[model samples]
Target: MPASDPVTSRPPLPAAIIAGTVALIESAGPLEDQSELVRAHGAQATRSAQFMERAWLLGERLGLPDDLSRWRSTIHLVVAALAVLVALSALGMSRAVVGESRSINAIAALVTLLGLHFLTLGLWLLSVLWPGAMSGLSLGRLALWLGARMPGERSPHALTVVRATNRLLQERRLLPWAFGLISHTIWALAFVLILAVLAFGFSFHSYQLSWETTILSSEFFQRFVQIAGWLPSLIGFPVPDPVAVQHAGAQGLTALTGADVQRDWAWWLMGCVFTYGLLPRVGFALLSYLRWSAGVANMGQPDSGDPYVRGIFARLEALDPPLVTDEERRSTHPAHTLPPRGPGIPGTLAVIGFELPPELPWPLQSLPVGIEGTTVLELRLAGAAAERQNAIQALGQIRPWTLLLVCHGASSPDRGTARFLRETSHRVEKSRILLVEAEESNRLSNSASGLRRWSDWLKAEKLDAIELVAFPEVGQENA
Candidate 1:
């Protein structure tokens, strides 16, 4: 398939983590400027699509995708090593069962084959029933930990990616299933190797298999063998009769030399291993895989509402140049009259200077005397995407009693400025626009005409509810 094909894309889980990692990185400090990316994708892209595209672009630039690839390779190597170790262990156990004496103790051999498997399987079950009980020390978690700690030239963001992946899996409750899937698969492989070894050993060599107990009576051994063989018998494997069972306990290694006796015992053992050991491992592995897959599919996308993500979207929105529409020429009569300044400015106010020229002083040096001690948050909303994004983010974090937006009185109001004001006006109890006149004598005539133009534009935009004021100089008398 071509590289750009959707079928060749990273799985949902990894894609989400990559995107989350990008968000984390950007939140810490800005990376490369994404203005070009915003321009390429434009405002028409969905938030999720834009986020994924940005993450992929930035992840490549920072070598995040390469880091993720390295991590995955390391995990695969660890899992392979673990599988090899398990197969070797199973081979050793099979050889031990038919030791120098060539005598297999039926009871001891069963325990040898399945004792550890059963213990670990029970522990996994306990962990599932009570989360954190096991501290997640499964073979799968071991692979992940070892992969992360493996010595290599890892990027600084590698650990961040790992953390994001783990957090995402844990939040979706898929961590246990992911670990269980690996553990069960390894165990199933071990069982498969054991079965192959046992079949080969039984087919070529002759070994005595009997039940021997020093403390228990023959009846106990008989009952134990009968009960253990019941399931195997249903599947056509032979279960020794009472007579053979009793004699086997009494005779020990010398009990059965007949071909019938040897064949029955061998088939019973293999049957028990298959029905009890291999089948369950395979079944549970399948279940865990299904659950893990479902979780990954439902992991979805990074939260668009998150502050950092929201800020990114805001920047992207700011990049799209607003559409310009022709308007009727300004009339001599004011379409909407400016309301008089109220009795007093609110005690808490947020003031934003929108697209003001560099020469204008911020945090106006002059104010009405009565409001000298009022709490105020002053910010500048410039033409740059970053500046607008910063302003929007800062304003989102607070809800003041009143919002005072200051604009350049000489510049005519456009759709962009009007859109910004309409969006931000709802974050406070009341909103008002202040038009600041420039000190340049050449701009005075334009400022006068701009005031009348803004009034008509505000009325057309249905923003007449927002109070408008005109400031004559840096230190104006108006509140």
Candidate 2:
């Protein structure tokens, strides 16, 4: 049997995006790890495949009971309901446009129907040229607002997902095509409903269709009808003859119009809506949807030199076993501690701080061994990825020496700290020790909840080779 195609096996686009987002949220390591996976696999494959991989990973992580798939289902229902709502709204507008008059103004209705759409399209184009200035006219915002208020099961989550996905893609400068897809779709649906209601109005109601213009003439109207009805006439829609056009223009329906002439005018009006209004909207909607799909398939390939793109590449680089960076050496022995000699000191020592408290003095004095010449490097646990990477690289360069990671015992261990330790372990072969320090007034024992939590994390990472030391009241003693 032949193997199934990866694209065919993957879920739909909505499902893939939602699943990938959930994977980012539930990832074991830092949120960056999921992005790293996207960059790594995406380098070798299409973005669609990378998206599929993320969905697969989410299923693997969350198992059979995951609710990510519910987001896609909810979105489909919401979109269907929106289409219906748009149709209903358009029906009301169509009735108001073709109102309760004994004689319908054919020129007014025709111009109003086509003119409004043209005006909207022009404004949409202008807004694209000058974004934010006309953001109030944005269809994406309208869509989001409607989605949030949609009433249905799980619709809230689906709408939230849509808003989040749109914002994220917008930050990456990829939302225009996607938003266009949605706008054109709504427009098409509205146009279709308006046309349907107009068709029904003409069929059931008996009314005279005439053109009344005090500024125009019979000759001018004859020429206008000839030009405007050219396309509709070609498609078999009945066009009024020059005599009937002159009669409608001169009499303004004061004389009784013939049934055949009225039928001809009705067909012409329906044809105008079909050709000029509905057809163009349908075409634009299809084009925009195609553009959005193309964007989704190629989302991994962002333009060069973009900061976010560069950041993704940096993540991919860090995924490799060996990475290089700059070096630095700094130390401050502001105050030295009376030596409490411990057996765990290596031949050469390096002290690295991870978000150490500002109150902790420089060249930490609590080390059981004397550090007369050892290099000391301080890094905040909450620092940028580049800073952490640089610290790891600097430590790797000075190896054959054991490394001590000093942290404040009062702060709880978090995933960020765990990720830093894991990444650092991959870079160097020396003994990696963890030193937790707090004022000696605090208890230091394995039974202490804070210390036990750190112990559990270390065991989970399988980095138990190094010692875990807690400095109790050492700060008070030194003072």
Candidate 3:
């Protein structure tokens, strides 16, 4: 398989739910070992594929999938409800301005129809340009909030899914676009309904349109009417001229007399609403939809390189038998060789080599520079049980604040090592494991995978407090 084909992509929502469930489970405690299960069910799959399958299996067992489905259904229902509310609101505004009266206050009607829409649109734009600027309650956010809580008892996994989805979208700066798409679509629906109401009203009903403003001059109204209608006029919508503007203002509360004047004012009002209100919303809604779609398409799966993920992969790899074999092997160095005593007396730090390979150096030539104070004891524990017991007894006498336990990276951690670590750790104030990589020809452990395996082993043994350190390769250290 090609490199990229190792793992398959999943839809954004389902992927988030599964990944979130995995995180929740891992956070709770060490998961039960799944080596046998993976070997049986996913033996031929790539490590990434196996990991995703494992996550899905666990998510199913936890009921996250069903919970997420219910939450999503609630969101859809709430969105539909919001759309209906916006449409009714638009219809009410249209009728309130032109319903009972023969003459319409054109400016007041415009404000009533577009004021809140424009305010919200402006805030949405601000949020896009500068994140968190429009952090206040919005229709889209309100819908999500209500959806999660309403309809029935809340699912336990609902919050986790939300947090996961938010985290994923926030990383790509797509959260605002997701919410904005909903807001703009609802606004667009409102505009369409408003236009429909206006067309029906103007066709069947007879009405006069005029502007009433005490302080403003007729010249200002004329300029406003012309400027506002320019774009709409270009698209073949009627715009009332200066004569109509002055005539309307001069009439004040009285209706404009001529049929032509009334017709011109009515169409111009509809034209401005279409041009300024509907068109902008439609355009922005399309833009938001495109962004949201692209974000989902490119959303990433869980990272394979993450330590937690690597740990899972390591366990899966362990289930496979070794493909190569050595016909002959020999051990030239002795099992246990204690390092000679140094000049200084025992210090606060004790360095012990646990089951180190015979070929590797004893009486360590170098130590990590970060570790402070003199080395109190350098004991090698290997071979017979007596030697191991002796090392543990020496540790009790020194009682160093920090104990550095060195081990070969290639060696798989066994029950013996776990027990020895638990016993020695109790004697010291703190204990750390340093894994030294062998030469390339003799190396069995891949650095990252090895560290993660050790980490997982430590967690399983309830030795999570002990830090696992990866030492530089022996050749690199000498170089």
**Top lDDT prediction, candidate number:** 3
Q: Can you give the lDDT of residue 456 in candidate 2?
A: 76
RMSD of each: 17.2, 13.3, 18.2
Residue pairs with backbone atoms closer than 3 Å in model 2 (clashes) = 439-473, 440-472, 440-473
The sequence of per-residue lDDT tens digits that candidate 3 reaches over residues 1-479 is: 22332134446557555765667657768654342234223423466555666676566645677777887898889888878888888889888876977668887787888899889888888888987766565455566677777868565677776666556666678878888888888888888888888888888888777788878888999999999889999999988889878878887424556677778888888998999899999899899999988877664355777788777777767655444445354344233222222222335888888888887777666665455666788888775788987887687666676888888887889877876776666567778888775563233245787888899998866678898764455677699
- Candidate lDDT values, in order: 0.71, 0.59, 0.72
Ten contiguous residues with the weakest lDDT in model 1: 334-343
- What clash pairs does model 3 have? none
Error of 2 at 105 (Å): 1.3
**Candidate 1 regions off by >4 Å?**
1-10, 26-33, 36-44, 304-479
- What TM-score does model 3 achieve against the real structure? 0.62
**TM-score per model over all chains:** 0.62, 0.53, 0.62
Q: Write the per-residue lDDT of candidate 2 for residues 20-101, one digit (tens) a residue.
A: 4543444434342442263325333443344344444444333321333554455566667767876776776788766787
Clashes of 2: 3
Please give, for residues 46-146, the per-residue lDDT of candidate 1 as tens digits: 55565566677667656777888899898888888888998899889978876566678887898899899999899888767876777656655666778
